[model samples]
Target chain A: MMDRMAVTTTTRVAELHELLARHETSPAAGNVPVHPELVELFPRGLRTGAVYSLHGSMSAALALLAGPSAAGSWCAVVGVPDLGIEAAADWGVWLDRIALIPRVPAGEWTSVVAALVEVSALVVAAPPEHISPGEVSRLLARLRTSGSTLVVLGNWPRAVATLTGQVTRWDGLYDGHGHLRGGSLRLEVTERQRTRYADLELPVRP
Target chain B: MISAAPIRVLLLWCPGWPVLAARLVQGIAADRALALTDRGVVVACSPAAQAEGVAVGLRVRQAQHRCPDLVVLPHDVAAETRAFEPVLRAIEEKIPDVHVVRPGLAAVKARGAGRFYGSEEAAAHALLTHLQRFTADELRLPVDLRMAVADGLFTAEHAAYSSSARQPLVVVPTGRSRDFLAGLPVSVACDRRLANLLQRMGIRTLGDLAKLPRAQVNSRFGAPGLRAHQLASGEDSPILRPRVVPPELGLHVAFDPPAAQIEQIVLRCEPAAEGFVQLLTRSALICTEIRVTVQLEPDALFERLWRHPWQFGKTEVLDRIRWQLEDLATEAVTTDDETLGASVLSVQVLPESVDNAEHHAQGLWGDRPDEKVEHALTTLQHRLGHESVLTSTVAGGRLLHERRVLRPWGDALPTLRERRLEQPWPGTVPGPSPATVFSSASQVQVLSADGAPITVDERGTVNERPTWLRTHEGQRRIEQWAGPWPIRQRWWRKVKQLNRFQLVDNHLTAWLLLSDGAVWFTEARYD
Candidate 1:
């Protein structure tokens, strides 16, 4: 049942580690906490073709749009019905990024992104219906390896999987921000390659 | 002469019971009302045949003896309050500054009303119309409603009680309220006991009360009488208070033709829910409970409660909603039962909060599995209703039957015991498990017959050593077999639990095998 899937996913991580080591990502060879091979995820703060938990994915996109400015961009947002965007705005990201979209039915939503895709680096799209595994596989295979990021949000997906080399799963909070609030994320990455390394949990900047 | 905005007053009484001048006054509906006897009616305007010098308060027989044409109206308290609503509404509309004196009286700042709504006469006409409409709408009043819009609440109130011939509306010129009361009788005010006491003191007119030393009247009449005096003299100070209203918010979507299909309904509602989320976003609140209400037919409405919360996004919301619609669509519909119709009438989001953050407070952020597990369970429940699906584990007993159970989650399982998984795990069941599990639905076929293995009757009877026979799709033979292990529970109960087991499926897809010494059963499958 579901137990098999969990076992399969766990086994895949070991397979991914083998692939990373094959790619020359050696633990003793690299100085940083993350394997040298996966450091490529943030090349100048651009989220290069990686899977992210919705909010974490959004943070990466916000990091890109805000540039080097300590105080990020301001926004006038709309249409992000289910997302509590204020959670991000508090981290010093300005609100000019917000815009309200009128009602968009679930079935007719993918095409709605054509206009938003060009201007906004990160357009939070709540797909109208469940995206099939075939659809997800199709989307992953079609990626041109460009620098753009898309964050798909939900209450919880029954299971998550994609056909990609790097599988960066979110394990949760990073230490030392504050007692009650303030901290970043601890993302455990499984780089599926044949050469060097994979399967490691590391805290990146918030 | 008055130079500033004139004061406005409205007096109204709904209805009570009748006893005295006080009772009649108490029973009046308009901001003000008067209890008039046949004799009082006669004294005011009736022909000499009706009046014949009959004074107020005389019995009907005495009035009839005094004047044969006197007309009488039995007291009506509720009718009076109903009658007053229109006048209250009218005066409220024309001169917002008015104060209600009681069931029968009202007053307005005359100078402003006269200038704005056009002369005092026009304003009074407007007030009368407003009251008349109220009477028609609320009281079903048959009587032609009447009222006087004057300089003071007292004058307007008296005017309301007066016959149409007596001028229902009169303008007491600026600074004239006091002057207008000069000839009025002392008993016209509500304090009849005080009025009678004053009358015993030889003061029968308003002028007589005003004529008494202010100090003497203050000492003799007490505060109620003093208030009554102030009212009679048109000098009462009004203290206005506003009414409190309840706080409730709802978001509704109306489609052009109404949708019956769940997908179509979800399409319209996701955005509406988004809109609902947006409206309440500024309030620093989150909802864990939502009741889905659907109006299928013009006459039929269906509603169910969704008690679940998300740690993050709206995915769980959309999934459960869609799955619920799917489950509903699969129902065994009858001729009378309407399939979901077209046009989703509305989706209402109930406000529930897991966090009571102030407007500026931040929600607790961290990786939380409970919110995650809850989201999954809710999605399953919405797609399955309360009965069909379950997460079953063997517990709470020593016997095989008693050892089986279903624990609750956000999904519908039998019970919920709040357990913490933050610490090192101990008692959880081992994994690498079966894919599909069952509880009460599928029955087992036993194959224990005479010369061979026991076979189950299609009706489930078995006298021989039973062999497991379960049917779903097709009959596939047992590939490999595992256990006849025993489970016993509920030693406290007279009927203890005794469950025997075996795993029989050729492909290594595990299926739970069992028998109660007497009968065998199939419990689950590894999908």
Candidate 2:
């Protein structure tokens, strides 16, 4: 199944490259780059002015931002105080440009997010419990106008894409004697805009 | 062979400037007698006080006795300098390079400006004219302003001092400075003791002093005498080097209909921001301090100074503008509308301090991964908030939580620690650190094999080794365990002590447990 997904993604990427060549413009003109492992999940690359919802694995979501962040784009993580900085650094998320606002007041969350979007290219946030659909829509509008991408950690109504990760197997530990060196996770990405789905198993390193 | 002649210098002098500055701030009438006193001595007195017999170096009581109605104000150096800032700005508008000698005095190289303004005389006249107009129109004070041009700073200052209010300017002809100083008193060359010595030697005037043999004067007066002889002979001192004036690059934007919304104002400022950054890049200069001015409707103005830890680019500029506008909008709503008013008529960005960009540019040999990260982090901080992004640093302490410190980005790392890390922390848990530290320790129950609750004694001893752990997740058998170390802190004052134990569960999850003689609390988890 993984091989089939890879073949289908390669064909889609080839078609995209042809279209891009005909247009005579760079593919990165209006897109944010993603990790090579996530190429099968987002064959055309992540859109610059859109939102994606990632569930289950925080490390996987952070890995998705490594490429763009390392390429000189600023990223912010909001409302996640317990986020392990060591884990983030291990996944190649440049800690220098990664802003972490552990918590924000519910009433000021929208404005804070808007402010962050004005300066940062990518903002990963967990929406507060009291946020309404109207507020989210307004934030999305601002994000679109500013050409910033939003990566939501939980369910975001009408998200452009949704990604979920499930750990398949844990390795490097025998009867708790050895350290937990790494693991394997099955990442399932579903695109709401194209009604397409892709799944791939990737290594998870802590 | 002959070297080039010395450059001409121009001096602008404002006599009794400290008294004038103090009176200006206090709104005292010009005709009133005012004396600035420092530590019971009169440092400076106004013209009115001088007329009544008050003078500098006089005791405050003596001045008061001389002039009964004298207003004695304490001398404030900062106020004098602050009042002089406007005068410097006015002079800089016409002249590119001007050096402030002190609060009441300023000097500039006259050769370039003289040629530009037709002659040395014309330059002095033009500067005096501009200053007189500025004092009359802007300052609205009748001040005694004087200007003079000559071959050196000392002669120029002397000429400015000798000029009367009617003329207010004196220009000594080029290459004739020695002749101009020939008739001046010997006291102008040195202190009273040297003047007395010169007088005793029949040298009553500067020309007489200049006529003495150089070696004879040097042998008698040492370096001070030689310097005085050089000055009297109209030779310029090598210490007075002219300062280089940097180019001023400022960007301004005026709204046609005036903008009130923060977003609209930010959008309008985009072009100016881009232009400002481009200009700085072209000049190879990086601005570290930015002065932003916001003009409001009907004469209300908002101004603020912003500083950057590193060089500021277009994104940082735009972010600061938005933040300032948002703050102003809030003020308008909370305060009276008449004070803050509505709408922004114009916005100006002026770089207050700049440095050569080449000095701070990244190297070409190695990859600067840290630089890229810092750039991104600062941009995010500009947008979100300064305190939102933080970096963790290890501090010296006995406890794990106390040793960890989180500081905002761009702040200097703390160097001082509460306790030395090299010292042995007797009660601290040894080995690898925990993966997760709970904000608050969770309560747990540890029981012996006989189904009795395990506890610690005041003597720092545990009841049993074999145990079952009951946590929020449910009961589990202990696989391996070590430690019942006791820590006594503030025992004399608060009387607090804790016994720490390291235990592993059946699931192989290690836990650091703390007991205060009663209950067990899970402090951290090693995953």
Q: Judged by lDDT, which candidate is best?
A: 2
Sliding window of 10 residues with minimal summed lDDT for model 1 chain B: B359-368
TM-score, predicted candidate 2 vs. hidden true structure: 0.44
Docking class of predicted structure 1? incorrect
Question: What's the true lDDT of residue B504 in model 1?
Answer: 40
Name the candidate that leads on TM-score.
Answer: 2
For B255-330, candidate 2 gives per-residue lDDT tens digits of 9898776777888899999999977766667787888999998788789877765677897788778767767866
**Residue range B1-527, candidate 1, lDDT tens digits:** 22223355333322221222233334333322222443333222122322265554566666666655544455554555555555556556656755545445445555566687777667667766676676577545433445454445555555455435334454455456666676778888746787788778787877667666656677877886676566556664433332111135345666667666666777777776666654444333445566556555465555666654232135545655665555455553533233453335555545444332232122122111222223433443444344322333333322223334433233322333432223333322222222223434255554422334443333333344333344655544443343334444322223233343344443323445555444455554432
Any runs in candidate 2 off by more than 4 Å, and if so which? A1-206, B1-4, B10-12, B18-27, B36-42, B51-54, B57-142, B145-149, B162-233, B237-261, B279-286, B291-304, B325-370, B379-384, B390-527
lDDT of each: 0.42, 0.73
